[model samples]
Target: MNAQTDHASTVSGRQVARAALWLDLLHRQFPELIEELAPGRTGAPGRSAPPPDAAASARRSAADRADRDAALWNEQHGLRGAGGGSAPLRLHVSDALRDITDGVVELEEAIRDRLGLGRPPRADVPARLRRIAGLLASVADHPVLAEHVLAECRRMSRRCSAALGEAEQLVRVRGRCPWCDSVSLRAFPAWRAVLCVNPGCRCTEADCECRTSPGHRHTWAETSWSQLALDAGVDESELAVLVEAAEPADGSGSVSGSESVGGSGSAA
Candidate 1:
């Protein structure tokens, strides 16, 4: 029992750290995306020559320049989207970076999660063979019979095709709505955040479309992991456990350890 508990704890720690690594990477990148979307830097204007007169000069300049202003505007700023494609080029690069950043993150995180769960702790798996081993071990039976247990561990593998399928199929509908836990779409418990499923009423705002519907009852996407797990027929804790298992291993089969299961990390 001590070995089982100790081993599980060690594995759990490694898993948490790896999961944190991926999450921290994303947390850092999210701000970068926000920054990229921000307006370009605005520097102080350079000094210019003063006009010969104040109000009179302004009126005279306006009247005189009005005729050529349209042409001048085009020449000074370059044509719309025609600054040698520099602005658009930079924007494309920025957008590409954003997309790669988002994609690599999702891919790496998904891969890591899959690896972590492929093999649960030797003790956690539920099987007839595992039960037999535990019963034998409890009676101080021979450890040579551990071959059966080891074989069972080697044979079992995690199945996350469901999660992957869900990720691809799930449509995120944004809105302003409190979290609710109905058989219908729901939100996360603590934060009451939601991701709606009403494609006809989908939104892309910071808050989901729930707010647009006056007095509408719906769940928050950010707050609904439990419901997703329930609907998927898995415990929410399984998500955390899977994350732990995904940590990159060192030279050995073991990992460095990770945070405790079902941590407060927001699934967002």
Candidate 2:
């Protein structure tokens, strides 16, 4: 492949991988959420109590409160019908999963037809995603087909994420993005992802260590929060404080901010 096509393929692959990751996370968490909302379900099988860490405990408390609120909303809406306590939540999750699964299956069929490929065996959500990703990889040289597949993957990812309430809680980090210097950095607690919203973020600077491509927005997972803080010239503790403070008082998914911090060096 030419350089341009190669770059496009790489970017497309990354996006597809990201979409798959997010969907897989939702697939795992959805069941947990259902269990949480279920009456007398207690917790997942063999789920042990969390260790005695204050921060961990506090996070669990916040999550518990959010679950309680969700349950209350279900009750208010009269969702607790003959189907059982978790039926409404289960139905919602099932619909979301089905939507994504169907979308992926359709895309797979389209790609298979275009390539004159034989029908594949039935597969679950994760397997379907993997098959689609493989199909995209095989068609990387075909820009139109690759792009189409990538778009479908992203659409499914977005739908699943919305269903899972992944973006429901956003905490505005206190500093500008270290790469783009835009004050558009936001931490999504539900997804454990931080995003720099600037589309033209210059994250490819020599000293910058972000994994995202230049000109695209940068994303960091929870593991990179400390690195993000370091790049933004803020202490990790301060970052934690800002995130906590920015969380909505009523647990509504809203953007809030704390005091701004001084800018750090341009490079991470």
Top candidate (lDDT): 2
Instruction: Go through the candidates in order and give the C-alpha RMSD of each one to the true structure.
Output: 20.7, 16.2
lDDT of 1 by residue, 160-236 (tens): 11111111122222221222321233232212233433333433445654557644434434345565565534355
lDDT of 1 at 119: 23
Q: Model 1 residue 7 lDDT?
A: 69
- Estimate the overall C-alpha local distance difference test score of candidate 2: 0.60
Residue pairs in candidate 2 whose N, alpha carbon or C atoms collide under 3 angstroms: none
For candidate 2, the per-residue lDDT at 158 reads 50
> How many angstroms is residue 89 displaced in model 2 relative to the true structure, after the best TM-score fit?
2.9
For 24-125, candidate 2 gives per-residue lDDT tens digits of: 543454444444433464557899755669988899678767755776687789655455344556556667767776886788788787777877678876
* Candidate 2 Cα misplacement greater than 4 A, ranges: 1-7, 16-20, 23-88, 168-268
C-alpha displacement of 112 in model 2, angstroms?
Answer: 2.2
- List the candidates' TM-scores in order: 0.24, 0.40
